[model samples]
Target: MKRLFFQLLLVSDLNVKDKLFKSAIAIFIRLTYFVSDIAKEKAPQLAANFDKNDLKSVETVFKSGLPTPDEYAREKVKALASNFDHSELKHVEPQVKTNVAVIEEQ
Candidate 1:
């Protein structure tokens, strides 16, 4: 009985979160799918980053519109800085911005 109720709660929570997250994202982003990977390591950057911590970063990034990489992401998100990426040098951009910024170079 308890397990069944937990499952029901999870479903409803997902529905509410889906609606809310989509509605918020639609306000600003207009993204499209792209193919990127190597050998057998292929996945969407956004989804891959969000999946870092059981999808917690999904809620954080989606809510704040931050293209955050895992471990660099925040939780309980609210408003973010317009220049959120400028964590250090204000006059120059970082060589490596985020996890997805640069996959590799040879």
Candidate 2:
């Protein structure tokens, strides 16, 4: 059982890492494009074009590689698993009442 649990964690961890890496790459690409766009316009300051969208420069960043739905949901799943791991249920003590009496049948 322990081995199975670890295997499951390992698989899920791999998936999360892949998704996270792709998402990081997407963000980096987007930031790079955004900067290049600002430089293209010969803007004196960043505030002038800070609100402009740069998706035009790298259109595939969002459509091809990103933090997909699976990535979003699995992150929460991992957090819930961590919470279960640290829960007090494993250390909980059974509460019993000593006042109960046993009756003998005649």
Task: Residues 1-106, candidate 2: write the lDDT tens digits.
Answer: 3455455556656766677655665566567678878787786665565754675546766576767899979998998987785346544522212223222321
State the C-alpha lDDT per candidate. 0.51, 0.62
RMSD of each: 27.0, 22.1
Candidate 2 differs from the real structure by a C-alpha RMSD in angstroms, to one decimal, of: 22.1
Model 2's number of clashes is 0
**Candidate 1, 1-106: lDDT as tens digits:** 3455455546656766676655444432322112222423544555567645756877776879855566255432333555466646654555545434666531
Indicate which candidate wins on lDDT. Answer: 2
Could you tell me which residue pairs clash in candidate 2?
none
lDDT of 2 at 6: 54
Q: Where is model 1 poorest over a 10-residue stretch in terms of lDDT?
A: 28-37
